[model samples]
Target chain A: MLDAVIIVLRETLEASLLVSFLFVYSNHFSVNKKWMFLALVSGIAFAVLVALQLSEISDLYDGTGQEVLFITVLLALSLLIQWINFIVIMPNYLKSNQQLLKILFSSIIVLAISLEGAEIIVFFQSSLANDNHFHANLLGSILGLGIGISAGAVSYYLLNQLANTGVIICLFLLVVVSAGMASQAVSYLMQADFIESGYPVWNTNTLIDERSVIGQLLYALIGYEATPSFTQVIVYFSYVLIPSASFIYFKIFSVRKN
Target chain B: MVLSKTGSSVKAKRLFLIHLTMLVIGIFSVDASAKRLTIEIEIKNHFFIPDKIEIPANTKIKLIVHNRDSSSEEFESYELNREKLIMGERKANIFIGPLAAGEYPFFGEFNQKTAQGWIIVK
Candidate 1:
């Protein structure tokens, strides 16, 4: 039962956190609630389709198709965040049409949710089918969902409070999250041998096992890996450092100079 | 200074994007040749049958994972970087590499305590 709870919580929290973050940010721009609703509905529907077609998807690209698709989505999301940053910085960027900007961000949020939600849905469905302890798993599932929603709410509240500090910090966090997603995609590529991973960097399994509760939370928050390969460590650090440095430079030095 | 910094960062991002795109295309093109040397493993009671599988080094091999239990399990390997969720009573296929001799450990993410296994590439 705890296993069921953990699985559902992890999956749901990942997507929910993204949703809450974006939704809270959208409030600052007065994004249309209706558009967000539509995006959420469609994202879930599309996720169902993806889950249903798992067999075919798994069979794609000689058994590495799932990783390919997953990577493509992660990269797309990363690019989308950069575009969002551009939109935010440029005045009259959407031709003074705030609605369009809102719609765009909402759609991307939907896409992120769909990808994460589909996995959770599939896991629950399969677990319910296989296990005899349905009631127990169901209870665990409910608890997981509750915890996930609470976590999202807490994040939304924190971001809302931090809005007084300006959108800079929020944007930084978003950039970090995007980088984490990209690193995860890289891991999949390395797994498929699409990318060369030279060696294991270090084993922190003794100090902090990624399977533990705190480790899982960190994984969802920032993609913590106990034992990462050489390639993964390099990519992860690059993603973290580059965007952050750029953001700080642009916000502080560039703004002051201007 | 800011403009140059942003510009340099954008260039780096673009380079990364191009590398990823090329790799994607390369994978699709090369996948055709990877459909050889099939290996089978079964899971029962959250445990992989014959948990240690030895295969020839430097060969592209197909892995067929059969999940005999009634529940689904995600076959995860940080070492191998391949993760696939195999539904109970169903079989899933995965492709693994032409590689150096090493031990690649894999386990069921859902049943990590019981479902541990390794692929020995020799």
Candidate 2:
């Protein structure tokens, strides 16, 4: 039961950070919250399908199917995050263009929930099985899930409270997380043997243990890895560079035009 | 040679694009031709069979993990940097390699106390 709690908590903390970030962004723009509802329903549907078909998924691509699925999803999610960065940089983003941004945010929510929700569904499927420990396992899962959602709700309000700095803060989080997810996509590619992963350039495990709770939360928010390969680091920084350059370009040129 | 501001900016942008392309290609040099060594690990009752594995350093290897348990388990290793959930009575493949010579510990997250092992890259 304790292990169940830990597992869900880890997955949820990782997922909810991004969800809250997107929620804040959508709120700032006054885009319809319908995306949140649509995302939840579709995402859970997709997750249930994935969990049910996992055996087939495990066998695909000569047993590399799981990695392939993760790579596709992570890359798609990363692309969605990158789009958010672009929208944030647009000088007129706040006052207009809510419709397309609405779709983008909705897609982000769908992908995020689909990715994390599958694990929860799989875990719960086992927990709900007939056994004496069923009650304990179910309780643990509910408790863990509650903690995760509560943390996300608290963060949403806190970021909204920042008011003036909210957009910048959200944008910065998006940039950092998107870059990290890009690196994760490449790692998945490497895991599938679709690409090679050179030995890690550095190991920071001594400084921040990856197994610790703090390490888990940092990973959720920033894509933190104690040991990162050369390809992963390069991919991460390249993502960072593109968005920063776009923000700077818009800031300078938009001001000049004004 | 002196040029207009637009010409200089255009040249710089072109240079940047070319370098970016090179960097991308350099990073993703997929080697379909290289054969990979395959290793098998069995998980029975939340324990890694052959709890210690040895492999050559700096070589990619395919790890076939078969879960023989009646319950699901997650194969996680921070040192080798991997996490995969293999449902009960199922199997999965994880690729890890070109690692520096060292002992990387791994465990089943669902049963961490009993499910433990090590990969010794030499």
Per TM-score, the best of the predicted structures is 2
Residue A131 of model 2, lDDT score:
66
What TM-score would you give candidate 2 relative to the actual structure? 0.88
DockQ of candidate 1 against the true complex = 0.23
- Candidate 1 chain A — worst ten consecutive residues by lDDT sum? A86-95
lDDT of 1 by residue, B1-122 (tens): 45688899999999999999999999888766555688999999889998999999877777889989887788988556577777667777776766569898999877667889999998
Model 2, position B100, has a per-residue lDDT of: 81
Task: Name the lDDT value of residue A185 in candidate 2.
Answer: 87
Error of 2 at B41 (Å): 1.4
Report the C-alpha lDDT of model 2 over A1-258, residue by residue, as the tens digit.
Answer: 887788888778767878888888888877788768788789879988998887789789998888888888999999888987787788787457788888888888888888888888777775654265678778888888889988988988999889759778888888988888888888878777788768888999899998888888888888899999899899899888999998889999998998
Best by lDDT: 2
- The residue-level lDDT of candidate 1 at A2 comes to 87
Report lDDT (Cα) of residue A63, candidate 2. 85
- At residue B121, what lDDT does model 2 achieve? 89
Q: Give Cα distance to truth, residue A218, candidate 1, Å.
A: 1.5
Give the count of colliding residue pairs in each prediction: 1, 0
